[model samples]
Target: MDDKYYTFSYKLRGDYKASPQYFFVGTHCANEFLDITKHDPLPLFNPLVHEQENHSPGNSPSSSSGDNKRLHPFNQELLTAINMLCISWDIIPKSGLDKIITFTRRRSETPNYNGIEWFNQIVGKDRQRRSLRIMIDQLRENNELKDLRFDESNNYLNERDIVNNIN
Candidate 1:
């Protein structure tokens, strides 16, 4: 199956409403769940490989030895949905939208969604909530910068910061 790319855009708030941020997201059609149990082999599908080299510098894993943990079932479902729902996006530093950043597949030596650790890792723990819409909204509301640049700056309001306030 061929991968398809679409131009995704989100409008900023106030004066920036005229010019929205643009992103190129790649997606495919066939991703229906077949209810594979832990014993069943994972389905044969193309994993999301990024085309852009926009990885965030100094973005090391927050986890360490013996820190391996699993998420609650409800949180696991939400994480899985966010991870696998979108294939690939161009933005990187805005990692709240990246797929499987906190937790990874079992085979990759990270916390597996179906592992014995019970899919460990809280979604928004010390990080932005894994969401695009919420991120955009927070960017509009939190940041004084009208352009919505994701650079390392205090002016920009990260969703992680606001999420803590909400909770």
Candidate 2:
């Protein structure tokens, strides 16, 4: 009956007969909570899964290509840089790349927009190459990353190319 706590209850509406469940809110204890939803929940993000996949057998950038020879050193370097940026940003590479492109395009719309100036403002001049902006630019400019196909302006990926690559 404390002022900070209250009872909450819910019940299923269907033919399944069950008593309502009660939850006491406003407990100061950190672990005292229940998930009262009817459906299962999935994680919004899992960095460990991506980290494991990156180090797994045959998942390396060199091995991903078809010719059996390692990827071009520049391509390899770019991929490594991009992977490091992804780790720092705590985002998956595919979605992260998309977000970078979207952010860049939005920034470009301003009158007298300057890519280098804006990027330096956000990431600082010293760390440009290691920053998300530079990593995304390198990825978009590289032809060796066959899974991606950029438009003429390099603003977005072709949906058909992405689907074909996936299959």
Judging by lDDT against the true structure, name the best candidate: 2
- Estimate, for each residue in 20-114, the C-alpha lDDT of model 2 and write its tens digit: 45455542221133233332221111212223332322323333212343333323323333344454554443423433433443443332123
Question: What's the lDDT for all of these models?
Answer: 0.32, 0.33
Cα-based TM-score, every candidate: 0.20, 0.25
Q: Pick the candidate with the highest TM-score.
A: 2
The residue ranges of model 2 lying beyond 4 angstroms of the native Cα positions read 1-56, 59-61, 94-167
Candidate 1: residue 56 lDDT (0-100): 24
- The backbone clash count of each candidate, in order, is 5, 0
What RMSD value applies to candidate 1? 18.2
Backbone clashes in model 2, listed as residue pairs:
none
How would you encode candidate 1's per-residue C-alpha lDDT over 108-134 as one tens digit per residue?
443332321221222233254444334
RMSDs, each prediction? 18.2, 18.1
Residue 28 C-alpha lDDT in model 1 = 32
